[model samples]
Target: MDCETGFCKNDVQCGGAGGRPPASLAEFTLGGYGDQDYYDVSLVDGYNRQVTIEPIEGTFRSTGGKYDCKKAGECHSNLLLSCPEPLRHLNSQGHTVGCNSACTKFNTDQYCCRGDYKTPETCKSSTWPVNYPKYFKDNCPTSYSYAYDDEKSTFFCRGSNGRISPDYRVTFC
Candidate 1:
């Protein structure tokens, strides 16, 4: 199948090479952080498709009234249709194929959360020329829209000590 991102040079797997940019990602750190699996659908690299990471059969905890384990993604939203003109990734046919994050499109310190803005305190999206991260967050509420979207987008589940490991269902749309 043809793909704008994550093409893998016609191979089924990317091997050691990373997928192309503007590809949605379901990131995971299994059995991490207090023996809980951490997972998220990150749009920080940009968004080529709708993605969801759902954990199956795990003990979920609540921290400060927020559930640690739950579904994370933008399964219902087709970001290509709503992508800003400056961040729109187009196919050969000139159709909108993906939506790039401000960092991917601009490559500036401010948008990328690097250089002087390397720290979260200095890299606030509200300080940008245009609040581009807000655009992604507004559309994909559950996904990581920017570099420091941990509070809203990161999820965790406990599956340790002979407990059944949670199977993740990653759905791409």
Candidate 2:
């Protein structure tokens, strides 16, 4: 559990994804982003599984702030249920794998926030497909539903030693 550099490019397990439940509940990397251990409840690429990063001792705990990842009102809007007809991604057993971003699903420059639309202003969320982003946002408000969600999406973590992390947990619901 010692990663001295940032998320290794080839490490598929860094996010605790791709594994079955419980075993994948705690996603950790000894190496971290920059000098700080940064993590996110990221859904920018799309998701079907519902996961949450409940901070044990961080700003998410200290401030009691909800930030972008707020509790939603409805089951469908809040939990990402019954994914849109076109956006569904099913595995061989017919269970949903993950949601695909507009960019992944459609390959459009605007949806991707690529090409001339790389900036936040240029890639306004208001212009993208409605329910898809809404589903992701409502389900995991703190995560990045789109490209420009970086500033608010990432959460910084550190242990008592004060040098980022050696252990972290990302829980799945």
- Indicate which candidate wins on TM-score: 1
Winning candidate number (lDDT): 1
* Alpha-carbon runs more than 4 Å astray in model 1: 58-65
lDDT of 2 by residue, 7-119 (tens): 23467464733432111122233336544455565555566455665445443222234432232211234233466656665567775555566665787888888898989
lDDT of 2: 0.52
lDDT of 1 by residue, 32-114 (tens): 86777888999998998899987664444435334466788854567889899999999899999888889999999999999
Q: Give each model's whole-structure lDDT.
A: 0.82, 0.52
Clash list (residue pairs), candidate 1: none
TM accuracy, model 1: 0.89
Q: After aligning candidate 1 to the native by TM-score, how far in Å is the CA of 124 from where it should be?
A: 0.6
